[model samples]
Target chain A: MTKKIPVLFSVGWNACINCGACVAICPQEAGFISPFDTIAVDRPCDIACMLCEAICPVTTITHELAPLKTN
Target chain B: MARYRPYFTLYLGSMDKQYDLVIVGSGPAGATVGRFAAQAGLKVLIIDKRQELGAPIQCSGAVSRHALEEVGITPNAEFIQEPIYGFGIYNQIGDCTTIDYRQLKGDEYGPEKGKKPLGYVVDRRRFDRYLMTMAERAGAIVWLKTEGLGYAATGNGHCDVQMRRFNEFLTIRTRILVGADGLQSQVGKWAGLRTHIKITELASCLQYVVDQVETEGLLEIITGHEWAPGGYAWVFPKGHGYAEIGLGVIPTMTQQNAQWHLKKFMEQSFFQKRFKNARILEIQGGGVPLASPLRVQFADNLILVGDAARHVNPITGGGIHTALSGGYIAASFLIDFLQEDRDASAKNMEGYQEQWLAALGNKMWKLHGIKTKIFHNQNIVERDQQLYATMSDYFSPHSEYKKI
Candidate 1:
């Protein structure tokens, strides 16, 4: 059986300004910013591109290539 | 002939003349890339079709402050007018809301004092010339009145470009080609890349730089079905008692000319009641691509930048800043390719795409999609009105209101 590539994702909490530009520009409809809820990254649909980082005026979004390791 | 010693080197590579890079257009994208690369000691050449610089300005000349810093250019105070604190967004029904990007806080938001301008409203002709001058100062050779007719692959990954400058057809051999030409770019089509922007996704625009108009400080955005179906009208203050008044309509919405509609809008009750008798000093018209974001930006030894690659932000129909950002990325990638001593192939260029996509492309895609749904929705007007109705009691007096 061919093994599937495990998806990886990370967003820096300190860097998120809740601009919603990411939510607006994600082609896959995967990025979202909500006033009442945390924006979650669904690995299967996430392309791991950080276009949100560039357009964000506040420099709030930073990405880590691999998912954070659980202690 | 005296003993021809097989003059050519490699399968198709020729070492006779080499340019570190060749950018097809002298617009924002090409100028930015040329400046950055030439500053780093790369042989860069930028070509433009127009005899004079900044002729026939296509854009509305709006860009964010953050975009300027990314390209290492500082904004002069004289260029800025109407310090945009926020956007006053009116819906199809004439009700409105405001989104304050300034409140978020950053260098882009201006100084922490009372209020500095969010960004400047510049004369594109002067601005484009300024950027081109910077590129020239950085050692990039600029050829004006030159048209890029076509390009041929020189066996290897390099290319032989055929261009006409001042009635002279010249062929240039370059290591890499950057397509910064705006929409209808022949460089993009010649590369076999899909640069075709559909009519439905295009905005036909006409703007008048009017003097003696009371534009005030606020950037006025008039929204309604009757005003502009798929696009909106803007009144941006250009300081010195003049304002840039314009309206854009989606191509499908109008078989009638854009300039004619603009004249009607000017005469209409909504605009003419106050700013009557405003003299129009200049009239400009052009196309703004609104296809959202493209899926790919590179192929073979070529890379596309600015409108040539469809990098315009869908929500605002603004691309100057984004294109400058793209220029920076393209220059960096070219430098890396040279350092690696590898011919710029798809694999090498893929890194450039990934870096940009990771930075701006994916978000542009999402934003464009959201803009499509919101702009095209039947209930958008009512929904926005309802949101505004509840705003009075929802927040403190000190807090700012956000409108989309």
Candidate 2:
């Protein structure tokens, strides 16, 4: 039997503007980043609330739509 | 026998005789109320919780010269930092445009004519103390280091205000109270008024005083997420070697700490290359309420003014002038209430609501709509930069000029 892990939507690295809207609106505190040091502050988005997707003005966020299977 | 047994009497305690009117917080609102009421011969007591009158100030200290002129306050050598002949804008793509305030159309927010400039960016401590001094000169009793604890309302009508001064509890009884406290005002809540400001409707702000800027007198304003998202960064020349370098963002888009965001911007590609040797002086942070027309700002015997009433402009986030205007209006309504013999209840305070709405309510509402429309764009960051560059010429002049 395979265990299922929650999959999260991720933003395109090149399109990410570092606006931080995703981090501000996320209820689960999953979206975290360091604005001062870009590229070093990416984190996993465990909560599937999609708050970031709704707030992304340019719609750069991509929904995974499927949970990853865990060993 | 007279049909009445001598009614047993109950004493509600002796009235505290400190002042007829007590104003909490010595910001622009308190100062205006104190100045006007004191000049009207009403005994006014002004109290501030801070050890000093205006230490740890929380404002950019920007104001229009016209606003001070209306209040009969003049800006001389001590207050005026720069005349600011024009405004500057920079886009995400690094395009720069300049706007001359003197050549602009529509109702503007500064002095009309003079070599001295349209607005002043004074030292906040000095400006606040100056206003407090003016109120004192008008016969208002100044009580520094005094903190307003709570409002004590009697079943009859008057209120006993509990204040702590130098570890001693003092009571002041007044027929009227003016709450000039800032955004986090306790008076608004204590008076049963709504203090709800949605996060999306707030501007998260952070500023730093930096020295040794390359730009001489030119104020630089940068837009786009490259610096601040849903907001802008400004480098206002403060004469000598100092400049107010800050950034702001609509609360909805601002995550992480404000200071961290500011530091990140300072280290950005543009700023780092230009401002390398500048020394950091002071760091400050605060929020500006941007909720169009606030739901409520008045209640029984209490009128919220300044940031307390959400008087800040929605688009510009410039509030010093509005706060000054609010102070004056709050004073006017208070004067009327002082002269009237009627009970100073919520019904009577309605006059203030009407007067404020007449003056600044509609402008704030229109600006709110403009802000909502501007923020909803999928590509606002790029669009804003374009808008700023396009309108730079129109924003330059002082008088009404067409946006070309």
Candidate 3:
């Protein structure tokens, strides 16, 4: 059986100011800043563009988007 | 584009079932328009997600006096942080070029003329709350700690809005819907308006309030890719010897994030000398959409204002002026549409877009052109002196103030 790879992403809520930068810049609408001043990035679109990771001001959006990074 | 509502939501109503105008986000744009619509004898409802108004501020707070007057706000001592007399602009090569507004404007702006200032930086928290009060005093019903989820157009220039108040869900209907929400305009998205803050047109920003560093009345602005790639760093005075030191960067232009860029910016000898013994007072970070002005900002029953419409200045990342002006413009058309034939159709709402473009759209496009030609290009990164020469021509004291 082939081993399954998982979609990789994490949010460092401790560093998140809850400014909603990621939410505003995500073209895929994949991210949202929680009401408790925390952030969650769970959805991965067909392209997995990773624009959220790039546009995050604090670099809090970490995602292992494949092919683009899996050299 | 239409969104279908659940059957359960159709029967949910704990408050007033409807309003003439329903506005989301009680920021400058939302509150201003809400005030006008209410003042014009329309039943208006305004809501905000923030428990407190303008908490964790996300602006440099600088606005021209003419801008405030245009919005009918007489500058009061209550929220005015400091009066900026000029700019302490620095080139990438460490050369400083300062212009005193008094000297630039001459007799028209000097003490002999009147108590005029180049601009004033106000406390955003207090200022936004002041607008909320203004909206409420004008007969607009405001609900705090309420968040707008989405809206569904119900034909004939009306919409059914979904929102949450604490644990209780709220669904309110309105003949005219206003999405004055800031940068993350989910209202526009839910209403099916193209309001995305694209990555190419995004500027990731970070700012800090620090004390113990004495700054003058002038706003210190530093330009160079070494500090903030495709963006700039600033020191906006916040009184009590404190200043908001911040920088923005085009994420696509650099591998590093805004935090990394700010860290590197502060570590430089120029900033190091200023913040040697400074204590951090507050830290905030956000994004500014430096995109070209939207050609269309309304659809059917819904109209977008402020950052939701990408109204921020493309080159400076400033929006208070246009944001305030946009509220007035929206209210102008809205008062007629809602009270006249009660028509909030896409055809009628297009009038709002036309008026807004006539006021500030061309100037914003010009700034976008300059932004694209220089900062976004990245080819002119090393030409510090050349950049200053061209910038002075456009931004100098003698330059056109209307475009600024």
Candidate 4:
């Protein structure tokens, strides 16, 4: 059974300058900034990596640990 | 809303027509190219991802007068905030080595042709708007709120570009696709070019535009691991008591984010004394690619310019001059490439890369090497005195880093 899992979320505390830093650095292509420059850097981010959190220039992204459910 | 109505449908209509040139991103680089190409009679279309061009202020707005003049813009009060005469380099403990530009000697990054003042801090929004305006006035159609999805070679000396505005999608068939989008260039990536900077090669920066902080009219550059590891902070005077206090840190080297480091840096007694009663105006964050310039900046009628091509100086994180120059080179080449009936193969586009290398790419590579040796040198990551000595030696226009 899976145990600890990392969940990603936008801290939402920082303003999205729409700089596209996170989108450029996401090796997994888990994030993107649209033409409208929306705050969907991680609209539905799946955490294979937390590079977005580490490299967000404004510190607007981070991760949390969650216990995995098993049968 | 200025951004609504979907430009994909409004401008191109339902017809599938091919433009001579299509540029993504309306920043200095994109607009410069658009202006030149359109003025030369190329059917040009420039698209921007934002509703209002130059909104959200993603840059520091500092550029040499030569940068503006090179792009054919005259320096005036409309955008010039203040002119800097020199720099004051400081270390972690606040040791300062102030140098006046008139008294200094350096190999490059010097005052251009005896131009007074090293550079001017600008209102980036106004400056950016000005460039885009020039592009539109030169007959290039400017479409806001349009995003370039990707592009592909039609395999017939033309390329197809896909873009979206709101919920609508449109395809722009063009002779050449120009990528001027910022550091993270999805278009360049689709063209099979290296578009992403290694996390270690990235400099994450946060800045606060505040009033009542004295900057002594000189750009105050601060260094040291305690404040900014693998990068540095600066205090740029905006005129009269307003200054932008900002710092950049290598994401991979620091355990803390830019905000955390900024907070710690501000909490220092030195900053506390200086920032007392200061009125906070605005806060901004951005990232600068501190890697070597991208070697292959073009592919099969697809070209990358500005930060999209990683043209920024690795040591100083400055891109304005290179962006304007590179945009000009790319546009000039595209004019001849199209008029001379040249094929769209990557080999044919080699002239753009060669011209850019002789003009600026070589300098950028040298800066990248020096940066790796000084700023990101893991061996001296914690050595304060040694770090400041080398950083100041290379960074100052008055001092030569080679002597060190």
lDDT by residue for model 2 (B1-404), tens? 64542233113222236566788889877888799889989888888877665455456666666778787787766656655545677776567776645454314533454244556677777778888989999988877767777786664557788888756687888877777766666677677676655567655667778787655445677777656777777788765668888877664575554555677777874777667777888765455555675567777656788877778777667767777887888788878777876677888878887898778776677667766676777686556754464335334553222210
| Candidate 3, B1-404: lDDT as tens digits | 65676655445422576999999989889999998888999899998988888877878898888888877888888889887777777777567788777777766654354658777888989888899889999999888878888777877567898888765697899998898888888777776777766687888999988887777777777887788777788888887667888998888779998988888887774778878777888988788877787767898788899888888888778888888888989988899877777567778889888888878777788878877767534466545544465455555667653444
Where in model 1 is the C-alpha error above 4 Å? A1-71, B1-17, B77-85, B92-115, B378-404
Model 3 residue runs over 4 Å out of place are A1-8, A29-33, A36-39, A42-47, A64-71, B1-14, B106-114, B376-378, B381-387, B401-404
Tens-digit per-residue lDDT, B151-206, candidate 1: 87787768888887667577888888898877555576677766655555666667
Q: How good is chain A of candidate 4, measured by TM-score?
A: 0.51
Query: Who wins the TM-score comparison?
Result: 3
Candidate 3, DockQ score (0 to 1): 0.53
Q: How displaced is residue B28 in candidate 4, in Å?
A: 1.2
In model 4 chain B, the worst 10-residue window by lDDT is B395-404
- Look at candidate 4 and give me any clashing residue pairs: none
Top-down TM-score ranking = 3, 4, 2, 1
- List of chain A TM-scores, every candidate: 0.47, 0.57, 0.55, 0.51
How many Å off is the CA of A71 in candidate 3?
31
In every candidate, what fraction of the native interface contacts is reproduced? Answer: 0.00, 0.00, 0.76, 0.57
Number of the candidate with higher lDDT, 2 or 4: 4
Local error of candidate 2 at residue B351 (angstroms)? 1.1
Over B8-53, each residue of candidate 4 has an lDDT whose tens digit, in order, gives: 4666543435799999998889999999999999989998877776
Q: Where does candidate 3 clash, by residue pair? A: none
